[model samples]
Target: MGRVVAIANQKGGVGKTTTAVNLGASLAVAEQRVLLIDLDPQGNASTGVGCAPGSVVRSSYQVLLGEVAVEDAVLETELPHLHVIPSTPDLAAAERELFGDEDWATRFRDAIASIRMQYDFILVDCPPSLGTLTINALTAADLVVVPLQCEYYALEGLSQLTNTIERVRNGLNPGLTIHGVVLTMFDPRNNLANDVAAEVRRHFHVYETVIPRNIRLAEAPSHGKPVILYDAASRGSYQYLNLAREILDALPIQAA
Candidate 1:
């Protein structure tokens, strides 16, 4: 069975999609079969991996609506072992339609379950809200990885996210747990960033790898390429590779 990890955080601009794209690519480069499920309607992850949302025929929306199978919705990326279930703007409406269904929270769980055995890892890129889509991602995931910005208000709403995870674990997915928290867009010159990192480390299982404020990381997405492929020597690329290795090392033996 594949290890399903949800790259989630209710906070936007925290590098959630960036982490999903790069980590999936990094794992694929390491010879692990990776399936990236883009749950966010923005479809940034889909674009980051070279899948144009507007051009995709079958997307997460169709899969969630039961119009297509997960395998049929999967799209090949530029990377050899990396595949993605692209999302479209239509997915934004899934939040409203899903609430009317009895198994709204488990829709994703069931959709992904049948395809779990095909890949070594599956990464879900969640939206920046605690809505039905995010709930679906959390319920489907075995582990959750939160990308936290190194800012003074970084801890704000974190309790709410954790509480939601607890509720999901208790009511929807009993095996759900936090994998680890990764600090993103870090700056060594900022004292506030250092302080926030220390505070997070004291309270949570924070990853040692910190993603620096790199221009290359910001630029790669626009080109529809991961930082590793855009510029492998960049700091952003190195940090994400470190994060991928750390994540692999931290996984359960079965998953590793």
Candidate 2:
């Protein structure tokens, strides 16, 4: 079965969507079948992969509500092996839509069961909050890869996220575990960024590849493409490719 990884960080601007889009693209480039779920209501991951939110007839919103089948909602991306389930703005109100429903937290998990074996990796781009959507993502994922920003304030929220993960493991998803934490937006010239990077590495099971603050990483999404497809020679592209390799090295596949 495929590994479902939730690219999560409750802290916003931490490169969660960036890592999701680029890493998914990189994995696709490596000949792995990948599915990216744009769980964040912003739909930036959809645009990042060249599938604009509104352009799709079915979205993650309908899938979450059990109105659409998971495979039917999957859309092909410009990349060969990468597919995405685009998110619409109305997905932001999914919490209110599923209010008082006992199975709200497991909707995403139940929806993905039929299609989990079709791909090598399934990535979910979680929103920047500890709400129902995020809870659903955590419940569905086998492992979590947190994108932590290189800022002092970012450290303050790490414990809260770990605590949330622990609670989810104890209750919702007993198999859930943190795969690793990735440091993003690193600037070597700044002492603060360097300090934060070292500190994060010392504390967490972090990836050796640190994603620098590259202009191409920011520019690619606006153009509706991943950095690897937009500018393969750019620093962001190369680092994410290396990150994908590193991720693949650590993953040991098992039957679902």
Candidate 3:
């Protein structure tokens, strides 16, 4: 079965989507089959992997609404082993519609269950909020990857996020666990960035690999490509690949 990981954080601009796109692509480059599910209505993950948001016919919206199977909504990305379940603006309505149903939180979990065996990893890119959609993502995921930007006030919202995860583990998904925290947009030159990293490290054992604030990462999305494909030689691309390797190393391998 595939490992479902939700890349989530309530705070925006923390490189959550960036990590989802690049890490998925890098893993694919390493011959790991990856499914990138765009749960965020913004659909940045869809566009980041070269799928046009407007052109996406079937998306996570349909999957969440029970209108289609997740496999039917899957789209091939430019990367060989990377597939995407795109998202559209219509996904915003899912939260309200789902609220009317009793099994709202388990909807996504049920949807993904059928297709869990199709890939090595399934990554859900959640919106920057603790709304119903995010809750659904949390309920469905086996593990959560929280991405924090290296800056002041970055840890301010973490306690709330941790509390939410605890609730999900206790009430919804008992198997849910935090995979790890990633430090993003790190600037080695900035003393504040250094302090923020130290503070975050002090509080949480973060992923050793910190993603630098590289222009290549910001520029790749505009070109409808992940940094791994857009600028493979760039430092950001290398860092993400290394991050993927670290993630893989951290996982316990199943006996053959």
Off by over 4 Å in 2: 253-256
The all-Cα superposition gives candidate 3 an RMSD in Å to the true structure of 1.1
Q: Provide the TM-score for each candidate, comma-separated.
A: 0.97, 0.97, 0.97
TM-score, cand. 3 vs. native: 0.97
Instruction: Give one digit per residue, the lDDT tens place, for model 3 in 1-256.
Output: 8899999999999999999999999999989889999999999999999997579999999999899988899999889899999999999999888877999999999999998888999999999999999999999999999899877778788878989999999999999998888989887899998888888777776898889889998999999999988999999999999999999999997432
Candidate 2 structure quality by residue, lDDT tens digits, 55-172 = 8799999999999999999999898999999999989999999889999999999999889999999999999998899999999999999999888787888888988989999999
Off by over 4 Å in 3: none
> What RMSD, rounded to one decimal, does every model reach?
1.2, 1.2, 1.1
Clash pairs, model 3 backbone: none
Q: Where is the poorest 10-residue window by lDDT in model 2?
A: 247-256
Candidate 1 Cα outliers beyond 4 Å, as residue runs: none
How close to the true structure is residue 128 of candidate 1, measured as C-alpha lDDT?
Answer: 95
- Candidate 1 is scored at a TM of 0.97
What's the lDDT for residue 143 in model 3? 91
